[model samples]
Target: MIEIKDLHKSYKIGKNSLHVLKGINFSVEEGELVAIMGSSGSGKSTLLNILGMLDEADLGTYHLDGVEIKNLTEKTAANYRNKFLGFIFQSFNLINYKSALDNVALPLYYQNINRKERMERAMSYLEKVGLADWAKHLPNELSGGQKQRVAIARALAGQPKVILADELTGALDSTTSYEIMNLIQEINDEGKTILVVTHEDDIAHMTKRIVNLKDGVIIDDRKVKQVKALENV
Candidate 1:
């Protein structure tokens, strides 16, 4: 569902340019759960940002669901991002003032979906993520694992084709992390493609494939027998 070829990106600081990604070629097929592993400055975030349409590559070709992703107008980019991608962040990114139901409904609000449908879809996703009982609660009222579950529900509310998660389990306790991964695994099993950026080996192993990045290049990409997060939890 995602393809990038010869991707290169550089940032200018003063007179010298720092190259972040060099000749990176990557692809993710539909229904695949992939983990990208890399240390600091290994270009993991850069690659993810480019894929998420939050940033642009200096030189590369990116195809998402059969559409070229480069040179998109801001409006078009926003539309494509909303239509095809959902995101989960390490911070949970939930608004403290908004109730869980409203947080999940925010994305649909931008799509001009009416209030009734938005609430229905958001409630359905909340139920799917096991957060139905907590839908009316605020972020602070939830536990860390519950918060992450709410975040996951928010990401799924749109039913996007691909979900891009950055350090999704980084902030939680080990058991909580595993719980979140288990939820992610269930989602992937239902055929939604997912790409996770994580440095944690255990987290990477939970996915069906791992793509290792070093010094701005993909050093290895291979499929592995999936590890069940529920067992580890």
Candidate 2:
């Protein structure tokens, strides 16, 4: 569902240019779950941003769901992103003033979906993520995991084809991280394409394939056998 060829991203810092991605190339098939591992300054987040159409690449082509996005206009790209891409950041990125249901309903507002139907869809996703009971709660009333669950619900509410998760478990404890990873795995099992950026090996290992990045390029790409049985819940 994602095809990237000779991708390069750079920014000018005064006199010098900082190249964050140096001609990186890779592809992700539909329904595939891939983990990207990298240390600080390795450009994993930059790659994710480019893939999600949140940022542009200086060179190379990016085809998402068979459509070339590198040349799309800003409005077109934003429309495509809202339709097919869902992003989960290290921070939950929820609106503190809104209720959980309202937060999840925000994305639907841009899609022309009717208000009643949007709320129904958002509440259904919240129920899927085990956050139905917390729909009326605000961000301040939740814990890290609960907030993350609400964020996940928000992402899934739009029925996105690709989920770009940047350090999704970075803000939670180990136990919460494990739970969150399992939840993501379940989502992937339901046929959503997932690309997760994480520095933790334990978190990376949860995915079926791993891509290791260094200095803005992929150093290793390998498939992994599940080390432990995933919970059936």
Candidate 3:
């Protein structure tokens, strides 16, 4: 559902130039779960930003769900991103003062969805993430894993075509991380595409395909075994 070809991105640092992505090429099909693994400063997060349309490539193409987005206006790009993509960040970007349900409903508020309906949908997704009872709690009131679960519910509330997650389990303990990963795997099995960027090998193994990045280029792309379910583990 996403395609990138000869993607190049760079930034200027005074007199010198820093190249973040060097002619990167990749594609992700509908319903596929993919992982991008790289070391620190290896540009995997930069790639994820480009894929999520949060940042633009200096040169090359990015097409999402068949629309060529490289030439879109900022307004248009934001609109498209809201409609077609869901994002989960390593920090679990929830507002400190907002309750879990409110955070999940925030995106819908921007879309002009009415309060009652938005709350209903948000609650449904919170239930899906096993956090319905915790919906009234604020981010600070919840544990790291619980906050991430709320973030996942928020991402799901949009019903977007693809989910782009960057180090989703990075802040959690092993057991909690496994629980979150299994939730993502369940969503993937139900037909949403997922592209995760992680440094952990066990997290990378959760996907159907792995892309290893080094020096801002794709070094390896291959299919691997799916991660066993948490129950199985």
The candidate that achieves the highest lDDT relative to the unseen native structure: 1
Each model's backbone clash number? 0, 0, 0
In candidate 3, what are the lDDT values of residues 3-87, reduced to their tens digit?
A: 9999998989999999989999999999999999999878898898888888899999998999887767889888888899899
- Sorted on lDDT, best first, the list reads 1, 3, 2
Error of 3 at 130 (Å): 0.6
Better of 1 and 2 by TM-score: 1
Q: Between prediction 1 and prediction 2, which has the larger lDDT?
A: 1
How far in Å is the alpha carbon of 141 misplaced in model 2? 0.3
How far out, in Å, is residue 226 in model 1?
A: 0.8
Per-residue alpha-carbon lDDT of model 2 for 111-176, expressed as tens digits?
Answer: 999999999999998999899999999999999999999889989988888999989999998888
Clashing pairs in 2: none
The models' CA-based lDDT, in order, is 0.95, 0.90, 0.91
TM-score leader: 1
Q: After superposition, how far is residue 40 of candidate 3 from its true place, in Å?
A: 1.8
